[model samples]
Target chain A: MDNLQTEIRQLIIDALDLEDMTAEDIDPAAPLFGDGLGLDSIDALELGVALRKRYQVRLDGDDPSVKRHFHSVNTLVELVRQHSERTA
Target chain B: MDALASGRPRLHRMTHEKPDGVTTRNTTLIESRGLTPPIAPGRMDSFSLPLAAWAAWPTHAPGCAAPTDSPPPPGAVDIAFVDPMLRRRLGPVARMALNVAHRCLGERTGVPMVFASRHGELARTLAMLHDLAAGEEVSPAAFSLSVHNAAAGVFSIARHDTAPATAIAAGDETLGMALVEARARLSEAHPQLLLVCADAPAPELYQDDITTTESAHALALLFDLHQSRRLHVARHASSGTPSNSMMSLPLADLLAGHRPDAAWSGTHARWEWTLDDA
Candidate 1:
């Protein structure tokens, strides 16, 4: 679980060109948009594509339950882990 | 800059051309009417700040004379900005466009606008391909966010603006198609139209056609009903230069050094000025 989270966190940092930030800077409880990380909608879209490719999980927009999936890097890693296990 | 002596080829130059059935020949390329933004490179960091932002945000618009220190009350119009740093990390397509829209508004409040991106959400596209290859489940949020009009829609959100917007992709003729829609919108109620054309570098797999990587920039035009300056659009007979090649002549050739004794000729749009002050 720690390894997966580390890998995903690095992916986000590299993918978004977080410039001055390290994965450590991204709090698991912090929001992705607005004051938390200042990512706009485009970032969300690009991040979405990255997650799909790396985890083999398809994110569905119509599912309101998906909100919890992106609540933070921690939440995302957990979701990906659970889904990957279920599918396996 | 040397006239003909030290000529280095420009990466891209717009040329004029006349296709069959395209009769118009004398149209102006761009209208430089509004409070002209300074050409200085350092100050205007965000390629995409709105007119009010240009007028109001002295720290952003380079060389702008500071507005009298009083803060002006907000109005119906709003400005949206996307700086190059964000673009390099995020998506360059929309960032290029938002730049032109920012310039077109100049000092006035720009009307609600529609922005078009021929290749939208490029970063997402690449990431999606990577995910597929890895056999991982794609993030649902990424898939939903990768739509073509996502940039313009995001800009609308950034400005807290509910103004109507449109996103389009029309191949190599993206600019021409965007102009057609902009003119149509002008026929409606909006007094000024902010039309932007933006495209990022093609991902390696898709590079066979869209060959630009240095970021084809955007040109924003503020359309005014009573404004004196006007750019008439027309197709011109080709100067024999191939359409696929970028500009054949350097801008320095046009500025003062190589001012053509006669009319300048190319395969793209040209700017012609007619002011009463003359």
Candidate 2:
């Protein structure tokens, strides 16, 4: 879980072009949008594409659960872990 | 010249005296290819370029050796004034344009802007086209910034400015036309206008069709109608040689005070620039 969290953090920084921030700067439990990371819809879409490409995880655009899943780095880690376990 | 009576516009007889006590009369007679007559004297307040910081640019000019070391990447562009998140989305050309425009405008805002480029965002456009051809989803950021006016639009957004902005693309005449537009805007309520011209080399697939010296470059010129320097543009017989890659190179030289006057031939006309003592 720790390794996956670090990887996801780095991925977010790189994929979103968060140039001034590092992986450690993003709090794992903090929100990823609105007031926390301040990412907007375009960034969300770009991040979704990047996450899909990297993890090969299934993501449905219309899934209401996606909003909850992307709430924080921890939630994203959990979602990815479950997806990987189910596929494995 | 009889060519003047061949149904072609004649060069208006005008003599301009340079600050250094040199007087020049442009005798090249041809049609007025673009905005003509009553060119109000305009002052160039400032200009900027990121590529000028390179130690030495790769040159194909005869008798000039290419640099031994690899050319430096585009110079440090300090756009700290802009929001970091928004800055991250800018490509090289857009970054260059914005950086120069900011430097030229300084603290001024709500002024009209004109952005000219021969091939605007060619790399981004090409990438989006390739993605489409490959049946892949095009990145929304790339698609939005790939438009010709994206630079100008981003400038307005960054400044939170409500002034009108125009984007122009006119082959080799891009800068000339942009100047004409800026000149026209000087008479409006806003006497000062910002003009930014930028271009990057076309992608390899289109390189054969496009010609430019540098891989990419951008220049911003702040023009005020009250200043003394003037630029006269008129159509000239097209030289048979293939056009150079960067149109702003000569203008850059003029702005840097290296030359009192400079002239360059474009696709359909000649541009003569001079600085005069008011």
Best by DockQ: 2
Off by over 4 Å in 2: A56-64, A85-88, B1-75, B237-245
What's the CA RMSD for each of the models?
A: 14.2, 8.5
Worst 10 residues of 2 chain B by lDDT: B47-56
TM-score of chain A of 2: 0.96
Per-residue lDDT of A76 in model 2: 90
Model 2, span B85-153: residue lDDT tens: 788878777776787788778888777888898888888899989999998778877877899999888
TM-score, cand. 2 vs. native = 0.74
CAPRI quality level assigned to candidate 2 from its DockQ score = acceptable
> Per-residue CA lDDT of candidate 1, range B1-278, in tens?
74234443222112334322122322333322221212222221111111211111121321122212222122212333544234334344554455445555544443666566556666677897798899865655556557776666655544555667777655543544455456445532565566655544455567675432223333444554344333333223332332331121111122222443212222332222111211
lDDT score, candidate 1, position B164: 71
What DockQ, between 0 and 1, does each candidate earn?
0.21, 0.47
